[model samples]
Target: MLEAAKAVFITSGVDAPAKEIADLAGVGVGTLYRHFPQRSDLVKAVFQREVDACVAAGPALSANHAPGTALTEWIDRYTEFLATKRGLATALHSGDPALEALPAYFMERVGPTLGALLDAAAASGEIRADVTPRDLLLAVAGLCAPVDHEGAAFSRRMVAFLMDGLRYGAVPPEPRG
Candidate 1:
């Protein structure tokens, strides 16, 4: 049922009516409400599921691909995830106090996995010491501009450049003593 609700939410936006979710889930309205008392509850569950998927991708990518390649692909996936969040932004910022913790939720749930991947890349000398996980995350976040906005492409290009700059042998500007 949660998966069905997420599918509907992703396709129709979280503001999609409960009846729509119920119909998609093949369940009655009473059942939907019984499972999720409020729209915020459903939204929270869906967002958490998405976040979990993204977090889980980190290890899978590292295990299957080279560290550098994994980091790059993960960044792309993170950008896509943010884009999906942008699609559901309306529901995210709908003044639901319960949903307010999502940013923190993402940090706690996704940040560690990202940090581990980044640390591995750094240890392997695939990225620079100054490059923190949050820096890469912020670059991806920057890609999530206003929907239908022209700047999104430019943002993506810039993030690509930034990620490329993170490759092995990237050098920090020398400090003058």
Candidate 2:
């Protein structure tokens, strides 16, 4: 049923009707409503799945590759996720009462998971000490700052630059006060 919602949302936007979700799931409307009483609940569930998948990838990537390479690969995957997420973000931020809380929910779930990965990479000496998961999040958000149409390749390049700076300590040192 959640998968149905995800498909509908992805193809038709979060505003896709509950009936459409139920039809896609081969479930009754009552069943859909029973599982997710509100439209926001359905949307949140769909978004959560994507977030969970990306978060889960972090540990798997780190386990399979050297720390620096793993972190680099993970950031690349994250940038891709953010590209898709621009649509989700737009839907969530549409001022619709139904999606009002989704932003906070997304951050709460995804932030800490990425934090763990970033910490692990730092401990392995793969990235600089000043790097934070939130900083990475913000950087991805910045990469997505341009218009969404042709922004994907552009954002990925920005992510590459950001990751390079992170790995090599590109920022100038501050003078002691």
The regions of model 1 sitting more than 4 angstroms off are 147-159, 168-177
Ten-residue segment with the worst summed lDDT in candidate 1? 167-176
Evaluate model 2: give its TM-score: 0.73
The lDDT for every candidate, in the order shown, is 0.79, 0.75
Our tally of clashes for model 2 stands at: 0
Q: Candidate 1 on 17-126: residue-level lDDT in tens?
A: 88888888889999989888988888888788889989999999999988778888888778767756765678778777989999899999888988988887776677
The digit string of per-residue lDDT tens for model 2 on 44-124 reads 777777778878888898789876787788778777666556546667877878778767876887788778777776776
Residue 145 displacement in candidate 1 (angstroms): 1.7
The Cα error of candidate 1 at residue 85, in Å, is 1.0
Number of the top-ranking candidate, with lDDT as the measure: 1
